[model samples]
Target chain A: MRPLPPTQRPNWRYIAAEMVPRWCPASARDMHYAILGCEASLFGDSNAASMRTSVISCDGGVVIVRCIRGTEDDVETALATVTDVGVAPVALHPFVTSGTIHGLKKKIVIRSLPSDEGNYKIGDNTYRILRMSGQKVDLVQQGIKQTTALYLNTDDLEDF
Target chain B: MRQFPADTNYSFLPQGRFVMKTADACIYPYPVGDASLRRLADELELRGFTGAIAVGIPAGCTVGNVRFLSGVDITANSVKSCRDALRSAPKTDVVMVHAGDAVFNRAILGNIPLHILRGIYHTDKRAFDHVSARMAADRGVAVDIDLSRIISESGSRRQRTLERYREISRLSRKYGFMLTISSGGRSLVGLRSVRAFVLLGAVAGLDELQVCEALAAPAALMSPHLSVEVIE
Candidate 1:
């Protein structure tokens, strides 16, 4: 074997310090020094564990968080505060017949899953999907003209 | 139609030893092969509830070994249909009808052998009124007060519901008709204790005593032999 150079020599003293006997009762001074060494290693040190950024996607106002291998409850709790404004968690009830979607002149069957730009049903007969900024849908019902809209939670929609 | 238990006593017990003899007026029956009924029975037993009137029980389905004695709920859109249906139905301990149209409500009030009148404030137009209240008082038809509507709704709709409930309460007092408060809940989470119902009655402008009376009304209606004695 070739002899090592002086610059490549191992720190014997440092290695010896780390090899303290487990059976030996640790003295207060020894414990203090050990803690100081640990502090040096842990605080303001580049060798410490690095934190990875969580994968998050926000399209328009719809925030989709990707939690790899996370439980449903954990993900739900993490996104508890972040919700899409004006968009409710309602059931998407498609019309029974495709003709039902196309037949109405006053009522438009939501053709595609509404993007941020699409109109949404707010009541039994009213909608606010035409313009994204408005709160009411002006339409004629039965024979009476009405302006008030009833907003329903997405969870309450039933498929008919 | 199973015969009602002849030995069943409907007397109100003293407080702390109170057994919930009052049946929940309206409960949709569990679907065939569903364990919700069994779970509901277990939950009722745990909650010290005696029995409930199972509404909308599917045809040919048998409800056996439940903790509570069960009754059937019959719903119809018109008075003639309701009458025809009731006449055809097999004899049960209690027969509760869902109040539909104004005509149906009026027709069933005094003429029919109905145990309970449910869904008084379900529609935009009130089905129950002062005239209906008078008929209910005369015929001994107990008005069912379902708490599920109050618990499930909010905002202006909830306000409307509360107003309707208040109106019912007012009419109940003026006409001296029997009133029974029910959870009207489909699940175990919806079932509330008699004490809790009384507290809710307070919110609906009914005194605690009136609430207890309401609870006892069903039992009294079921077994005429049992006399209600209010302690307070």
Candidate 2:
């Protein structure tokens, strides 16, 4: 059964944003798109509440994110890597080197490889490492794209 | 057709200063000349809003006068005022008009200046005789789809919605009036906050123009005070 609906539901972000000044440091509003994050009150440390939001859309270059519903503390662990915030945070391509793994911090590194920025896209799902958690990643290590076909061609239409 | 991007399903943005609409998108108790509407219009302008449309019989009003994108929600008192709003709205501003609930009498639908239909009102059936009288007037004028109140109430569902839209569009074309799809907010997420709605609209055969129009146009036209900027 659905829960009873609230009588007055002013857009939560607007309420949170409008109410922030009473308890916040930043007064300048994100007034254009008018998208407001609750973390507006707790600025500076991004990894705090601001770093974690739900994914809306992401291609190689462009990405769009949205508000997430969660408690105060569980925001980080509940989502992807802590590095997973921000617009185009990291290229999505997979590369290999081998570092170490403290359970989920699986890492692999390399000394040198081809240096190309445009070749790497945000949604490419690839990673590379050499030293991880005091352990050395092992490989004759091959780059991720060399063995997989996960890359997508999205050049025609624009949904940005 | 544009398809969903590969990494489209996921990828959260880092906590960078982001931009959002100036204020909450609200459906006011309009045509009442209340302070909130004036304040809303001013607030909208200060923040750069550029588009909106008045519901019911848009007769004398200008381009962004309307709110409550039909099927969003309406009250008994609000409905009558809305009909008055419709008749007095401007030609361009009167993008679309509603027939209220199909079951009601003439008083509810009133003498809406635009299109006529078997539009559904509140959940009650065998109801207000006056509203029925308003709707029952013009016959063979324009083909308005009489939907089951159960479904037409919040026509937000896509699979079922697209069909209703096609009918509305067809009728609009035949009558030489523009088609405006009412938000059947089954689960109405804030239009400003969600990107999923943009993606969904893209996939649902809405062209880029429509998607962008939905994003800012309604708010802009209805409330003139909102400032708007175009990104190239």
Candidate 3:
């Protein structure tokens, strides 16, 4: 493959930008392609060439990779063999957006019940607005002796 | 000497300090924010942990290069409830049971499917015995040895923990059941580096290769597709 021009040589940031658009909505198989593409672009052809035989695919978000003479064992070794190019697996979200509710520290209601210990509750009362972090929320409910923290997705909390 | 912490936030980990370590992954067993999984994956890649696994990930969350495995911790004593939880855990890649009464441990080991019994440890009572180890080995259940318990406790508790590990190690050798050593930390500070985990394993009477094998046990449990080559 021809190398990009000096001005256009894809850096990590550039590769990441290319990946962000397809990341969230892409299927697990597509996500594997994104990861491979980013790694190949940022780390250059040599590293990518070595990983050529390690075919990475996914089933239900679980990664399944195989080397040339692949078996279950080869997959593990292949995974360990990959050089850590310091590539972040997921895209970083910008703190600001064009919306009324900001990201973290914003108050949101517990639209859904939490599945873990992070949920805060009072006597017979489960619905309340809690302060949000990235995935965690500071829950302080009346009648509950101690405050608790909860995770967002599992809790199914909605923004108020 | 890779260590899988039972719970941790990759976002809170000290980038510089953690990145330099030899450990490749830290299993976060809690629900990480949808956006944070990606961000943390990016941060981990930047820090040289090209392979990090996050458990208990919620649905609709997109995973990048990082491995995302779902799991749930079963603390219930009722055999029916535990079995029900295991049966319903189709999305979970691993199932960790908090070992309590010996009867409950036997019930879990004998009846649960081999793939589903990923981890069984965490108890003051002597939950694992000769019979339990044999059952686990036959069924492919891994016995988890959480280093955080040894680090946090003191005096008699620490000694008991060490003794329990030694016994488990012996059983592991005799029966050939998989042993997984984890930090089981809730925070970055609680998480130990690979060197520390190896040393802790040594103190628990496990040799270096055994410790390494213990570290790799989780990888096998996470996916049926992963299997480490046996070195002669």
- Which candidate model has the greater TM-score, 1 or 2? 1
Show the lowest summed lDDT stretch of 10 residues, model 3 chain A: A13-22
lDDT of 2 by residue, A60-128 (tens): 222233333332122211111111122111111111111112211233221232222333222444432
Model 2, range B124-212, lDDT digits (tens) per residue? Answer: 33332332433332221222222112122223332343444444433333343212222221111111122222333333344445444
lDDT of each: 0.47, 0.27, 0.46
Candidate 1 global Cα RMSD: 25.0
- TM-score for candidate 3: 0.47
C-alpha RMSD for every candidate: 25.0, 22.4, 18.6
* lDDT, candidate 1, at B40: 47
Off by over 4 Å in 3: A1-160, B1-26, B29-53, B59-66, B87-90, B114-126, B222-232
TM-score of each: 0.48, 0.27, 0.47
Give per-residue CA lDDT, model 3, range B1-232, as digits (tens). 1111222243323222121122222355333332234444433333333343345554313233334444555666777887887777655556777676678778878776534333333454467788888888777787777766655554566577778788888889999888776655333223344545665677677888878777666566654443467989
- Lowest summed lDDT across 10 adjacent residues in model 3 chain B is found at B14-23
**True contacts reproduced, candidate 1:** 0.00
Which candidate wins on lDDT? Answer: 1
lDDT, candidate 1, A1-160, per-residue tens:
9999966853221000111011122343443333233222322123211211122222222222222222222222112211111221111111111112122212332222222334444345534432111121111122243222222112112211
Off by over 4 Å in 2: A1-160, B1-26, B29-39, B42-48, B53-111, B115-158, B170-175, B181-205, B208-232
